[model samples]
Structures are given as structure tokens and as C-alpha cells.
Target: MSIPGQIAAALSLWIDSVANTVSARLERARGAQQIAISEDEEGALTLRLVSKASKDADLPPVRIGIVDGAISTPLSPEWSAAMKGAIVDLALRPSRFVFRPLELPGRAVEFLDGIIRAQIDRLTPWSPAEAVFHWTPPQPIADDHVELTVVATARAAVTSLSQALLDLGATAVDISTATPGMERIAVHHQRIGGQTGSSRLRFALIAVLAIAGVPAILSIGLGGIVTDSYDAEQQQIQRRIAERRAIARGSQGGPGGSAIELLARRKQTMPSAVMVLEELSGILPDHTYATELRIEGDKLQITGLTHDAPSLIEILERSPHFASAGFFAPTTRAANESGERFHIETRIKPQFGSGT
Candidate 1:
């Protein structure tokens, strides 16, 4: 390979290695975790180190020790040692950091690191050297644009913190701002030597992979259309054959009209879907969202996600249009932090013209 080609390949391999390392570490950390949660409380910085045990695979975090301004008692030595390879989260008050949002062309996002580094001074109240800034992962918006939340804080504000952490021994350090009712925003982090380079290389690799996958995506899309058309044609032919067979059989067999009328009458006795939906919209909590709703005759099956699923049943049972509101399965946490997935069934109350 040429020198540049070999360099690209090396960068690619390094990027993959770093990603795999971080992913594996995170996976293990989630199972058997120890996080040093640092907070600035009443002008005093405290680090609370905790470990979680997976009891029946549902782990609860146990308090390890509290470090009041970088000092710990009893288990200080244990915590110091543990801090060597542990991920340290330094929490600060919202007033300490300046949060600013920046919108940039999505096309220029590939060079975001460079762009941010260059414009950090202009974007923040401090000089580039004095300010420690970190931009949140770009969120894509309309018109091929992206929005970024840049949190910048003065380095001097946490100078004592840097010495204390390094003295105790910490592998990776992340500084985050904690606000009421909002998720902690990681503003700055200590970078390992290869990580910064790896990030750039990772994006490059993604672009290359996407370009390579374009042809495959196109082929698959075209193939799907052809397959769908063929399937539809086969289905139509099968339906015609079935109808012909039914007609031939109908001449010899008894009429199925009575059975059909009985189904129609049963359908007529069912409750109104619109009334059921209106009741649900009025009674259910704002946080709840239904993913799957199925109505068969008078039986209604609802599968959805919510912050509180148990409360949903009570709300449903209270509604005039619903009865027998209960969960069919256990609720589990959703993929995103949205809430828990719930499966519940209820009986719909029949309305005057609901059956029709």
C-alpha cells in the first residue's frame, strides 16, 4: 500500500479498536458498575462512589463512600485504587457553565471538531485556551441543518479539581452540568491520545461505508418493488382460484348466509371505536403513548409504552367506555429513556350505533 493508503488503514484499525474497547467497557460497566458521581454542593465538591449488584439481573447501586472535597474516610484507599481505571463524572452547578446553542450546516458536520476548536473563543465568553468547551452530539434539524448545544466553562473554576483527580488516579474524566428536571449534560472530557484522531477517522470510515452501501441499498430497493409486484400478482391469482373453487362447492353445499348474518349481527353489537378512542385520549396520562391498538368485536387490546403503566389500567377501568382493564404482560423499560412498554386489554362498552 502507498504511504497515505497505509496511514488511512492504520487510522481505520485504530478507530475500530477504540470503539470496540469503549463499547465493551460500557457493556460490562452497566452490568457491574462503579461510577464516581461528583457534585458541587454548597461551595464544596463531593464525589460519591457507588457500586451496583445485579440481584436477579436487576442491580441496585450501593453507596461505596463519600469524598467531601476530594477527601474520603474508612474506604478511602479502596476508592482511590478503584478510581485508577474508573470513569469519573464531575458534576457542577448550572451557573458555573455557560450553555450556548449553535446551528451549522449538516454538510460541514464532518469537520465539527476542527470547526468547534477554532471557533470556541468566539462562541464562548473566554479565550480558547482559558475555556473548556464541549458540544453535544449534533441533532439534525430541517433543511439539511444540525443543532448543537455547546456548554463552556472556565478552566480556573475547576483547577483544584484537576489536581485532586490526577493525584487520586482517574483514567477518564467527564465534566457535566446538572440542572433541575433535565438530564446531566457532559460538557468536557479528558481525551486519551488516540481517541481524538480515532473520532475523525471513524467519521471518514462511515462516509466510505455509506458510499459503498449506496449501490446495495439501491439494488435492494429495486428488488423489493419487483418482489412486491410478483407477490401481489400471485395473491390475485390465488384469490381467483379460491373464489372459483368456492362457487363450485357452493352449488353442492348448504348456504353459508346464516353464518355470515350471525357475524354481522355480532359486529353490530360491538362498541364504537371512536368513543373508545375519545375516552382513552381524555383519561390516559399525557406521558402515555399507545403503539398498538386492536379492536375485535367488543374486545380491545392495547400495547404501548408509558412512564407509569400500572396507573394506565386504573385510568382505563374508570372510563365509561372501557372495562376489565388489566395488563397481559409485564412492563419493561423502553429502548429510549421514554418509558416502559405495556400490554393491556379491556372490554369496550357497546354504543347505540357502535355495532353498525
Candidate 2:
């Protein structure tokens, strides 16, 4: 079989899963079958306890077993206390610690991290890299895999919660800063096969019909306006064609520049240049004067001089109408009438002719 076929075959047996977190106590039991199972229970469930620590030496050991589900005994007292202590320690830190049902703890951890980071940035200035997160596995499964659980809290929060737990006669130990764990089971359900191709064809046909109906529905509702809009567009296109042909007729020889030149000449003949010059004159400062003005396409480059080059660049940068303006190193001249003439140049965008 091909690699993809092998993967697909494997996927067929693999069950999709979601991360789950259970904040519970572990009980030390002698026998493996310590869980209390009820006759009324219909399904299977696995229970696990995870301990988060600041250091390896401070962590407490937890044991788990299967027993009758009807017996309502807390899993592990020593481990449960340790887990509670972790929660208390997490709560005391500057980090906001939330003990949520581990149903979707992976997503919960992600959202909590963002919330804590934003809160920390607002409350105190700190770098996220300097922050450390220490986590311990629930139980080591050989050397390669271990069951781990994590609680995300800020350093400040840990300190606060630790002190509070201490007053309550609980010895809160520091563990890892950030700990995350996942408990996922590959649940198998009876695979019932169904027709796949027919469903795909039906979905495609429904999508096509839905898309085709939009233009038809719009045209029907705006029938009169649609006719007027089509007529206007046709007229505009015909007018442009006529103008292009006339320009092409004139540009028969001598290296043609029909499309761009015609447009440029039309723009140059327009009365907007005088208005733009007037606006520029009003905005120009006392000492600055335009020595040369060049207009290319819709760009206007003005070569001018100001006594202070840096101040001129600052003024241009602050202007709302101009997007970006840079000053070139000014060329200094001998003491002319204007006392050491320094030439500077700047560029600005010119309002373009409306393109159809």
C-alpha cells in the first residue's frame, strides 16, 4: 500500500479526541482494582490526578486504582492536598489562575495565557520571555511519556495565594511557573459506513444554485435601475473607444505614446494646477520657497530651501495631507544674499484625474 493509504488506514482506526482536565484527588490504594464500579453504570471512564510543582523535590506522589463506582471515597488524600495547595499557590501569584473543568483545558490554557499576559502588561511592565513556567507530569509512563497537568498563573499571583494558604495551615510549595497537561482517550465508536459520493454531489449542486440565484434575485428587485445602469456603462465605454481611436489616428508615426501622453495632456490642460499651487503657497513656511516644480504622472516633486533642514523634514512629516516626505542632504552654497544657502527637495502626491 502507498504511504497515504497506510496513513488513511491508520486514521480509520484512530479516534478523534479532545483534551480534558480533571482537578481531583488521588488515593493511595494497595490493590489495582480499588475503584468502586456501580452495576447501573453503562460506560467506561478513566480518572487521573496531576500535580504541578515548582521543583522536583517538593512534589508529592499520587496513586490511582479502579474500585466499585458506588463507593464514594476521595481518590488520594495526600495527593489531593497537594493539588489543592497548587491551586492556592497559583491563586496567590500576580498571574490570574483559574481552576476550570478540564473539559477543554487546552483551549482554556491558551485563552488564560493571553488574558494573564495582557493583565500583567497593564499592571506592571515586564517581558514575557523572562517569565518561566514549570510543569510536572501526572505520572511517568515509562521514560518517554508521562501524564502531566499545568496551571498558568503570574508570579505575583503565586506569592499572594501561597501566603493565604500558609495562614490556613497549608504548606504551599513553589513548583513550575507554567504547567500544561492533556488527558485524552482514543474512544472507539461502532463505525457505520454511509454513501459518500452522493452526499458530495448534492452539496456541490446546492452551492452552485445558491450562488447563481444571487444575481437573478438582485436584477429582479432592481429591474428599472439595472437597465439605466447598463445604458450608462455602454455609453461611457463607446465614448472612451472613440477618444482612443482619435488619439491613435494622430499618433501614426514618430514612436507613438498614445495611451499615456493623451491622458497627460488632458490633465495638464485642467485648471487644478493653479488651485494646488495656491494651496501649496498657503502651507509653505516663511523662509522656504519653491525653486523648481516638476509634475510627472500624479507625483509632484518640489526643490526648495529652508534655513533649517531638520525642521523642514519635521514639518512635512507632521502634515496630514502628505503621506511620506523625506529631505535629501542639502548642498550648501557660499554666503549668498540668503546667508549660506542650503538647497533641499521634497515630494508630495498630486490629486490625479479621475480614471474611468
Candidate 3:
């Protein structure tokens, strides 16, 4: 890509990164979310914690099960503590989960999920849109065969469970199978009832939308004013470049002169400030310092500080462009620094105008 294109892409990435960082920080500052997971009395995955209005009102429930190849009691903590205002992850028992192993041609492995989704109505008791399913990583069964285990559950069950959690004030809910010694994959239907979005996040989203919508709005209301502005600027730049190129070609082989050539001829008839500065820079000593320089007509004035101030007149006179070199002001020694200040004036020869 061109340098400008790369720079613009980098700038856009930086902007988006900064915006996401700000949004994340604002969300974190609001609070850390809590989530609880356990099996209920009905043997279904749910966020309904056994209540405790009194000790006799309800004894805290306890259930022990092997999760991820380890024996850990999932119901020891107040399921209510885990469920109150937090994103909940509920790992249902493997027995409760129905796993269907599917074998198909290897070519369909890449799009296996989409294929499964397309056949959801035929494969499961639920419709395509009403099924919540998770599939294991596809395993190669043979040379041309791929095997996958799809875990299917009804979306209505999850929706009902999530609504029940929301009634008890859950932020979000995640449903996964507690398969023996296997890491859970967050399937297509991870979160239900939507995660709570912070106000800052909403504001940032609105700002992003507004920024994205600006060109469209401008095209409609201002009749592409920004587009016209860019086009006009681009045309002006192209015109100026073309004008300069034409002038250069004319100077080489044409007759009618452009403003640049007219300026060049005028410059040839007179001394240029740049040439004088270059000549002065070449002759100026390492320790010598020039503070100010002035030129009027064919006369030049130099104000400087130097170790040997009175010797500059000889140096200036040695150059053919300068003549009648003499001190304009009395040399004064600097008190704190080890240099003498001197002001000199000289006649500038217009013959120094040679572009060579």
C-alpha cells in the first residue's frame, strides 16, 4: 500500500483501540459481575437458588457431582450469591445432556455448524430458529469421513430459565454441558436475555454510530458538501502541479514564459538572499556566531559575536561579491561570555546573482 494509505489505516486502528479501551475501563469501573451455577430440585439447569427467609424456611441445599474430571460440590455456596447481579455459567450434568455423534464427508467439516443448523428441524424435535445446540470439535474418523458430537436442547427451555433468572436479577446466563474431562465450548447460544450494557458503553456506541452516519447525513442534507470540498481541493492541487510542470517544459523548449521564469529573470538581475547566506555560512568560522543579518539594495549588514571581531573586515573583503567592508559600530566585549560583539557593513556586488 502507499505511505498515506498505510498511515490512515494505522491511525484508524489506533483510534478504535483507544475507543474500546475507554469503553472497557468505564464498564469495569461500574462493578464486577457475579454468576452462580447448580442443578435444581427438578434436575434441570437453572439459576433458582434455594431461598432463606428463615433457617426453618429453607435449609441451604447441597449436591455433589464430578465436574471436569474433579469432584467438587457445585451447590455448597449460596446459589443465590452466585446468581445475584452476575453473568451465570450453568454446567448441566452429562447424563442430562443428549449428545448425538454425526458422521459426514470431510468437506463439510468447515461448515459443519451451518449444515447442522440448516438441518436442525429434521435432526431435532425443534425448528431451526428454536433450537439451542453445541457441537464438539470435529474428529477425523477415516480418510474421507469426519465425526462430530452435537448437543441439542430446546431454546424455549433456555428462554424460560433465563427469564426466571432475570426475575431474580441475573445479568446474563450461559448454558454448557459438564462433559467428562472436556473443556466447554461457548456455543451459538451462550448468553440469554442479553448482557447488561453500561451507560458509558451505550454512549460510546452512539458516538461511533454518529461518526459512521455523518457522511450519509451530509450527503442527504448538505448535498455532498464534504465530497465537493475534497474534489475542489484535489483539482486545485492537480492544477498547480500541472502549471508548474508546464512552466518547467516551457523553460526547456518553449517561448511564452510563466510567472516562475519571469521571477527567475528578475532574480538573475539581482543578488539572492539565499546565495548570500550560503556564501556567509561557508566563510563563517566554527567559533564565530551571527545573530542578525540585513540586506537593503546592494548593501549588507552583519551583526555577530566572535573571538576576533576586528578581523571580519579582511575576511569580507577577500570575497569578490563584497567591497568597501568596514565596521558600522564600535566592538563591545561580552562580560559573561568570551567574545566581542561587532557590527559590520559592506557593498554587495549584483554580479553575485549567477545561479551557477
Question: What TM-score against the true fold does each predicted structure earn?
Answer: 0.39, 0.21, 0.37
- Consecutive 10-residue window with the lowest summed lDDT within model 1: 55-64
Poorly placed runs, candidate 1 (over 4 Å)? 1-33, 52-85, 179-181, 191-356
Instruction: Give lDDT for model 2.
Output: 0.38
| Candidate 3 per-residue lDDT over residues 1-356, each given as its tens digit | 67567545554544544554454444335553534466654464333343223322343334544333233445434554544555555665565455666665455565554567655666667876777787788777654556677777777666565555555556555567644447575432233232233334546666786788778777676767777788679757855765565567568855655665656545544667888998899887887899999999878999988876657888989987788999765554322455666789997765564432
Candidate ranking under TM-score, highest first, comes to 1, 3, 2
Alpha-carbon lDDT of model 3: 0.61
Whole-model lDDT per candidate: 0.63, 0.38, 0.61
Which lDDT value does model 3 have at 183?
54
Per-residue lDDT of 312 in model 1: 83
Q: Candidate 1 vs candidate 2: which has greater lDDT?
A: 1
For model 3, which pairs clash? 34-86, 36-82
Tens digits of lDDT, candidate 2, 1-356: 67567444433322121101111111112111111111113222222223333332343333232233221334354444443423221211113332221111121232333323333333334344433232233343432222333333344433433343344333222232322233321111111111133344445555675689678868787997888799679757865775676566558734566666666545533335565576568677888877776655434566765544445556655654344555332233222334213333444433334432
How does model 1 score by TM-score? Answer: 0.39
212 Cα displacement, candidate 2 (Å): 61
> Candidate 2 regions off by >4 Å?
1-272, 339-347, 350-356
- Give the range of the ten consecutive residues with the poorest summed lDDT in model 2: 17-26
